[model samples]
Target chain A: MTRTRKPGISRRSTLALMGAGAVTFAAPWVARAQVKTIKIGMPTILSGRVAQLGTSSRNAVMLEVEKVNAAGGLAGRQIEMVIRDSKGQPQEAARIARELVNTDGCEMLLDGEASSGSFAVHEVARDLGVLCIHTCSEASSLTADPKQHIPNAFRCVRQGIHDSIVGASYAAGIAKTKGLKKWATCSPDYAYGRDTTGEFVLYLKKFAPDVEIISESWPKLFQPDYTEVVTKILQAKPQALYSCLWGGDLTSYIDQANIYAMFTQMEVFAVNMADYTALTVVKNLPKGIHSGDRYIKTFPPTPENAAWGDAYKAKYNEYPTNWSWQNATAVMFLNEAVKKANSTDGKKVAEALTGLTIKCPFGADGTVTMRADDHTLVGYAIGWGTTIPQEPYVPDVKAGDWKTIFELEAEWKKSKGYT
Target chain B: MDLDALASCLASPACLVTQTTSGLIIGMLLFLVAVGLTLIFGVLKVVNFSHGAFYMFGAYFAMTAYQLTGSFALAILAGAAGTAILGLIFERVFMSRVYGRDVLMQLLVCYAFVLIFDDVVRMIWGPEFKSMGMPAAFQVPPLFIAGGVVPPYYLLLIGVALAAAVVLGLGLARSRIGKVIRAAAQNPGMVSALGINTGLIYGGVFALGGMLAGLAGALAAPVRSLTPGMGFSVLIESFIVTVIGGMGSILGALIGALLIGLIRSFGSLGFPLFTEGLMYLFMVIVLVSRPTGLFGKEVA
Candidate 1:
């Protein structure tokens, strides 16, 4: 066997060289770290139909950053946000996160805009050992999947599991009141969609044993065509559709489904149905459509929400979605963590973020507290409402049980083997 | 698996009826898009990768035209004209330079347009989906066709596709210009020797192809929501159509598109999971069984 001293340099020699290089590289970052401004990096989708998701998140982060900086920044240090467009792609997100951490020296990361992108960034965070917060991703696996779990990574948004718990519990009531038992699923064919759909269906059937899921349709996210899906649903004659489709895809589905009289045949219970951006594009949003929103001013119907909405509208010329609240909360959580730990050190802030509570401005019940076990945020303003033609597009906000959400989320986490 | 889908289809008569009509309407639109792709390849021998972009431009142009004029017909014509001009520019500026180049160079040139057109559309329309309100004339009550009710707009779409076929397909097969085109495609050097500018022929073919795509997009705008990447969704199915129907064969495009359109319509009803897969399956089988495609000639 040829002793392959084959490489340009031996592994041990390379390590020695790298060790020296690391020390040299570490000095500048160390010097920069002493600076008062804490740099935060966000990789988000900024183009395509789903651009609103990222744009909303970026605006939200900026809004919070503005407030924090105005009050003399987080822990009396000004926070700077360096944003990059992920294009809703996983690899791009991961690559951008690494560059932000390694190159731009982003001390903290907000890895999200999409669940898939969030997961990719989570792995990057784990490898880089950064105090990272998942801003808008809702996949339960971000915190629950044991293999992917890391101490430094935490999600600041409401998980899909939380949404489903509230959604299913609310759906059971709809099934009973309207006698709409025959169910069908029309979710985007991805983790967030599949997870939310499965959980909602599994729990709905659990809630109402007699409820039957007659059919299902999994169109790819950002799917342009929903004709076949609509026709299939029409053919199935299901009394209702539980959809996880959102943004551009959701708007397209509603418009096309309307053409096929899908709304007439069955009630559409869409989890992400109430974004003002998409609602305005849709020609005819049917009245009395059962739906839920991520974040809207009318949901909490409080003065705080009103002021925030007006301020957000004044800034962006558009109403904020759940992303606005989710992202704002993440940055606010960062502020709380840094203040609590009294340092921006990744490990210390990571430790401090566990069990941290903040006044969630969009919380239906006032505030969300971070769970210590998983470092995942809970008590988001979770709720469902009816879609009506108006400025808010979602009114008559009915709050979901936060205590039930936490309890179910805990039980669900245990089932998934999450600590 | 196909048998399972067939079984599912047989179980629902109304589903079968609605699906068939829906498939044909979709197929007709695919035919419009595919016909242009096939014709361009047939005449110009350039695999125009940005054909879908042309289709997208058509939808946008028609939509804007309709918005400005408040006339559906003018929008349709404007869509056709708008893409034709773009296609002409693509041919004269970029495509003409790459005509004699390697396949890779040609592919790169057209592929560049895909990115360019996408961003351009995004700049103009933003990243949001824009819904085209159904024109009043086509908003008549749905007609009961076979066992299912059909949108009147679908019929109008069929009519537009048929008109395109008559003007394009028949016109290409019958007219003196069509004769020149066919001859030019067969032996461009020979036609050039005979004092005809093959350059004009290539531009015309490219423009016509773009027009057809624009027409399809314009027609589809009412039924389907217009988004920046709407063209990308059409590209895959269009590829499947042109592949099944021999590249550069007009009749081949028509038949292949209908075949795909029907497969999707019925496939979604029968086997929803395999809608896209079925197209790939057919393509693989066609490639293996008949490399020149169903109607294509084996290139020497």
Candidate 2:
């Protein structure tokens, strides 16, 4: 002990060493303070048939993020998005969401998954207790069903029930005018497809009692061959066809249907066909195909909407899809929540997000509200119209009434035992 | 359980005719893909897991060619030639090294190429699905056959598949190159000693297989949506066809493809929910009953 004391530094030297150690320990904290960043994890389907969904969502989110960052970020803390591809798999989506928070140090989650992947990500958000905003999944059960609802999660995209109510109302008018009674459906065999199609049929029947679904074909998601499905639809010889097949599936279905001249035979109403992705790609896109206004530069009928669409197209060399606006709105809502809360804490930000309303280009009246009850978006543009091959594909649009949409949505939730 | 519904669907002549034609269309497409896979296995004794990737590349190449030349015929030629060249290079560089190696080693090598080609396709063509609209020649209203409508493009595919079957079957039976290929497959050492370039035969056979797959892809481009992973489903179906018909047998591939196609079409009508499962069920039954397959020969 005596030898050790002799070898050790004197009081002044010991003090100097202690000071150096303290400086070393405090350096990281000082650096962190100087360069603070709030990371948000985005789990999306970036690699399969729905890759465009993720690409467009990321483009929109980044567009908003760039604007916010340019204006000096939220409370001087820059936002860093850590995006991961789920490969269109549900388990992978859940795993990536967990990894984004637990391992990658993300403070929040921006879930850009489709319905199946979204459900898995929802569970992950609940387990991790992180704030999550669903920007793409439209399946009503995600929010309307209390069993699936979580305190920290919200949806910025349109819901299935809302879409069904609006679509049925629009289609009923056409059905009456055209005297088209018999109908058939060919949707992807999945939750979003089945749920939306069922809701649509249920509401279609309610609105137009004369309409009957004579045949239904549920093709596996990303099914390569539509020959059999097209054949079946042709055999049924329905006056009209209603399909919820989306993204590549919808494009493929339309292309294959054209080969058999199926569209010529029936009045096709595809809920997802109006978006530019499908509109621009389908060869000789048959005219007069009725579709929900997924995303169009003109439907919102605002300078802001047009400006945003033009800017996005200019930047990405591709027109934005329904997902792009929803995701951009999600970012806007998140930014507002962060500003209002003035804290990066998940609980505080979440509480601030509850029922938050913000001005957006995609909103029905230049403003959208995050409904307090379901934590889902409302007051956004909703409509159906006929498609043309050229630009301004859907010229005449019929907008959905949010008031009626809400009333019917509540009843739908009640019927599903989700109230 | 719904006997009336089933009966009504089956009872309709138009329905039966349409379904049968649909089956034939699908069967012909499967034959084009399976024939290549079986040929590769027959000569190389390698499963060629990447055959599907070749098919995908064929479609992409054909698409690019069609876009550039606006000639579907030229596109088909470019597709088959491009994929054959790719197959030749792959055979010379990677496949050549694994000749006479362990079965696992061969499979691993082929599987590795599949992954590589998949990524390559995405990098080149991108992940978005694409469509080559049916050529102007086949864009007319569908041809009616026995009260059922058939797309003109599908009829073209059927014609091309039948033509290929006749040419390949006869070529293998009597052509000089075909005799050499068969001889090499039977005894590579003896063929090599007889001054025949067995390596060249192997390369040629592999390229021919790739060409057939490529041709199938080009024909299918109009009807099937083109994606980076589109080949995988067709590959699985082709494998099932080969297994049911007898691996390494062209006749077997044709028969198996038709059976699977008919089963799928009818299965969808009878049991819509289990159409995919029905294919697997048939494959399972075939495997259980005949491990050697309908036309596969004993190795010993």
Could you list the iRMS of every candidate?
2.0, 1.4
lDDT of 1 by residue, A173-221 (tens): 8899889889889999877788789999988987788899888788887
Summed backbone clashes in each candidate are: 0, 0
- Stretches of candidate 2 off by over 4 Å are A1-35, B1-13, B298-300
Report the C-alpha lDDT of model 2 over A229-317, residue by residue, as the tens digit: 89878887999999999767788788778878998899999999899988887776889999999999989878998999999999999
Which of the numbered candidates is closest to the native, going by highest DockQ?
Answer: 2
TM-scores, one per candidate: 0.91, 0.92
User: Which sections of candidate 1 miss by over 4 Å?
Assistant: A1-35, A146-148, B1-13, B136-141, B298-300
Cα lDDT, model 1, residue B281? 94
| Shift in Å, residue B76, candidate 1 | 2.2
Error of 1 at A366 (Å): 2.1
Computed on C-alphas against the true complex, the DockQ of each candidate is: 0.42, 0.56
Q: Is the docking of candidate 1 incorrect, acceptable, medium or high quality?
A: acceptable
Query: How much is B294 displaced in model 1, in angstroms?
Result: 2.0
